[model samples]
Target: MRSCIWKSLTLTIGFSQNLWAQSIHLNEVSSLASGAGIASKPLLLMMGLVALSLLPFVGMMVTSFVKMAVVLSITRQAIGMQQAPPNTVITGLSILLTVYVMHPVGLDVYRKSERYMNYRSSEFFDKANVDMLLKAVQVSEEPIKHFLKTQASEKNLQMFYRIAQKIRKAEDRPSLSMNDYIILVPAFVITELTKAFQIGFMIFLPFMVIDMAVSNILMALGMQMLAPTMISLPFKLLLFVMVDGWHLISKGLVLGYPL
Candidate 1:
């Protein structure tokens, strides 16, 4: 009788487990059937959030953000600040300036998008988008062309014009297209980089003089062990402040670009 009771108890536990497993399987099957017919709202929302997260990065790459940020960052570094003004501050300033520079182009894009969404007008959307982008490219192109004319040789111009001509021929157009805009972006970027370096060299000269003078004075005064950087930093800051260096730099940068 004892053995039979133990056997019955074991059988009961096993049966319960099997029933539970079957119920779980049924639940999974039901879920699959329901999921097959419709997308979950949560999933759509998650995807939208992911796309939104990437929007800033896309804007940085495709707009004036990259050039502005790079130039400002380089200028900060050249000043020998070594994160003195802070990366966040530099980036924030760059963003504000980029917004100012790109405002008109952005307005054009926004107007076009609004018209398309409100009127279901594909033609207007296409026309507006293309025209806005072209205008932006044209604006950006002027600065780049100016830089190239000053820095690059005639041979470089020939090569660039050849590429532009090829692009025009491929599109069977006498004017630039969106694809041409792609080529112009990198060309413009290179031009900006070159100009930034040139400007950085000029900016570094005064600081370098201060550094050398401080180092020589420290050594001559039998204080060779003193760090020149610590001694020179204050003077550099004072000079920068007195001369309104920030204003001069910002004005030069803003004016350097062709309208």
Candidate 2:
């Protein structure tokens, strides 16, 4: 009876000790996890703040903002209204139009990144890891890259690719893909600027005609003292308003994007 009691006591003590050890191990793990979570929040927050600061610049570089802004500015110049709409108004309008055109691309990126973004942590900061962030970027960039490609001309892409190859060492050239942003971004910018200039040129023609006609009339009247632009300004404004220039320009710009 004594031996059986001792054996049962020993087994019970061993079981209890094992349970205690496991509990300790679990508590340590939980504490460490919680600590890591706490640490990452501030880092993530800092990075997010930085990103927000740079967001406007990034949007301008990657989206249709370049084309929109350039076209709008040129239109303003064409109207000879340097300060009528104000720089702020032009920039704001471009931003609005850019957002309108790029909304679909943004949605596509969100959908593609949904899997990586959805996590049990309840906050993005808690769930964000290097691997997860990289994966999210990788998935999200596909839509953006596709949009860029659609806007970018093949000739520009090839030209940039050739330039990049020439700039890099032979060994490095193989690592540089045509789809790389270094190649795509400048190419995309060039393409957008080229198209914007073309639109600007067409816009300039009508205004140029007005200026020339006004100058001829002023010369014929022996009133060369009056600047043609000053005389033509009212006529230009009348013409623009009559044809609903703003409406047409906005419509064309917004619709021009492939979505």
Candidate 3:
């Protein structure tokens, strides 16, 4: 009876050991699965971040922000305000102005989107969104067309129109695509550059005269070591401020485009 009891006890111990080993294997499998899930989460998060980063570019292209920002930057640089007023300040101001100018366009887009969404119509959504985009483009196109018409030749316009026609052939209403308007953007940009340079030249004229006069006077008085820039800069700033230069410049820029 003692020998039979010993054999039974040994068999029970063996079974218990097998069960423990099985539990350990299952635990390892669970740990591996959890680790894999954690690893995949980071990849998904990284992809989402990448997509979000592209949102600004998309917004800029879809809005009037691009031209507004570029023109503001050009104006700032032309005035020799290098790093003065800070890039952050300039960018913030430009963004604010852009939003102001684009308020109506944005409202139109929102209204169209909301109408489509309420009706639960995907087809209408596409058409409405495209129409909204075209409206915004129309606003931009007016200024561009005016600039191009002033600067470009008749032949250039004809060439641009031909190219537009070819490119927009797939559209149902090619004229509504504003294909010619799209072609005018680069030409308008060139015209803006020319006009800005002309303005910059005029701005430098008074400063240049002051510099030459101050240098000549100083040299004649044997104060050759004195710098003219120090004197001229203050006068330039004073002249600029006295005439409400910022107001005039801003007004001129706004009026330069057709509403």
Deviation in Å, model 2, residue 231 alpha carbon: 0.9
* TM-score, cand. 2: 0.79
Point out the higher-scoring one by TM-score: 2 or 3: 2
What stretches of model 3 exceed 4 Å from their correct place? 1-81, 108-114, 117-184
Better TM-score candidate (1, 3): 1
Between the candidate structures 1 and 2, which one is better when assessed by TM-score?
Answer: 2
Q: lDDT score, residue 93, model 3? A: 71
Clashing pairs in 3: none
* TM-score list, all predictions: 0.58, 0.79, 0.51
Candidate with the greatest lDDT versus the true structure: 2
lDDT of each: 0.53, 0.72, 0.48
Give per-residue CA lDDT, model 3, range 1-259, as digits (tens): 5332222222222222222442444233223333233345454344234434544653454344555556566555544467766888767776876666555544543443343223322331133432432333333334323434654445555565566567554653344322243444444444545565666666567657767887898889998887877656676677768888767756665555443
Instruction: Report how far off residue 164 is in candidate 2 (Å).
Output: 1.4
User: Please, what are the lDDT tens digits per residue for candidate 1 over residues 1-259?
Assistant: 5322222222222222222442444233223333222234344344234544555654564455666677677666655678877889888887887667655554543443333223222332133332332333333334323333543334444555577667554544455432333343445556656666777778888988999999999999999999998899889888888999888877776656543
Ranking by lDDT: 2, 1, 3
The candidates, ranked best first by TM-score, are 2, 1, 3
Minimum summed lDDT over a 10-residue window in model 1 is located at 6-15
